[model samples]
Target: MTPELTRDCQTVADRLRATGHRLVLAESCTCGLLAASIAAVPGVSQHFCGSAVTYREQTKVQWLEVDPDLLSRHSAVSAPVTDQMARAVMRRTDEATVSLAVTGHLGPDAPAELDGRVYLAVCVRSGGPGASRDGRDDPYVVHAHALRLHEQLRVQRQIESAREAWQFLVRVALADI
Candidate 1:
């Protein structure tokens, strides 16, 4: 990891520890880089639940329970699909208080418009003072973002995406969201 990314991971770890939040991840184009970066931090096992690398559409559906309609409508790399991926991952693990999902087309084979486009989503469990309200389970509040990488190489794009994910985590963690 780059020094900046390492710092970001550490910052996220520290903030998560302080806020008593645990994290899970769902990944696609960046593969497992985001998970790997988080795992690099010492004692991360306490705050890090796990990650799923759902590279294919089938896996995204089977593993993260990403809706086929959303994928068909927006593609796996779009914001809606990524947001649902985050919510699904968060729901799958009781240990996770926050979930981050990333999907993107970062490749030489990607369509021109989507070649370097990536979508990231962070879902934070909410409902203050109660697990449920009005007899319904608490809902996760999701924050999503879109990014375009300037890198041409697949590896470079992946690295850039990973760095962006870490940075996003830092922002959310610090905000206690």
Candidate 2:
């Protein structure tokens, strides 16, 4: 992770700790980089839950309970998919109060349409319409980011996306959303 990303993750960690909330990560293309960055923060053990490095679609389905039809309709790297992935990971563990999900194609060799595209989702256990006391609808805070695929190496894109994810986390966590 880049130094900026590390600092952002630390900010997120500190903010989460201040609110007494722990985080769970569901990562796809960037793998565990986001989780590792948060773990690097001091006192993170109190605010970090765990992560699922679900690179394969099947793993997302099997472990995170992502709907296969949803993946088929939106592909694995979309905001809708990442939103569902975040909700799944957040609910899967009782320990976390917030969840962050990331999926993207950072590529020199990605599928034609997916290259350089990334989707992110952040879910707070108690803040949304879906997370109501009755456990009804579950809306997530979702976003998408992209860069020119040919403008950077795959590793560089991954690093950039990781940083973006950290920044997103900081925004939501600080707002207590």
Pick the lDDT winner: 1
Q: Per-candidate TM vs. native? A: 0.92, 0.86
Q: Please write out the lDDT profile of model 2 over residues 28-77, one tens digit for every residue.
A: 99888887878888889877889999999999999999999999998998
**Lowest lDDT block of 10, candidate 1:** 127-136
Output the number of the TM-score-best candidate. Answer: 1
The digit string of per-residue lDDT tens for model 1 on 1-177 reads: 778778878888888777778889999998998899889999988889989999999999999888898889989989999998999998898778788999999988889989899999988878422254353464788888899999889888988998888778668644665
**Backbone clashes, candidate 2:** 2
Q: Rate the local accuracy (lDDT) of all candidates.
A: 0.86, 0.79
Worst 10 residues of 2 by lDDT: 140-149
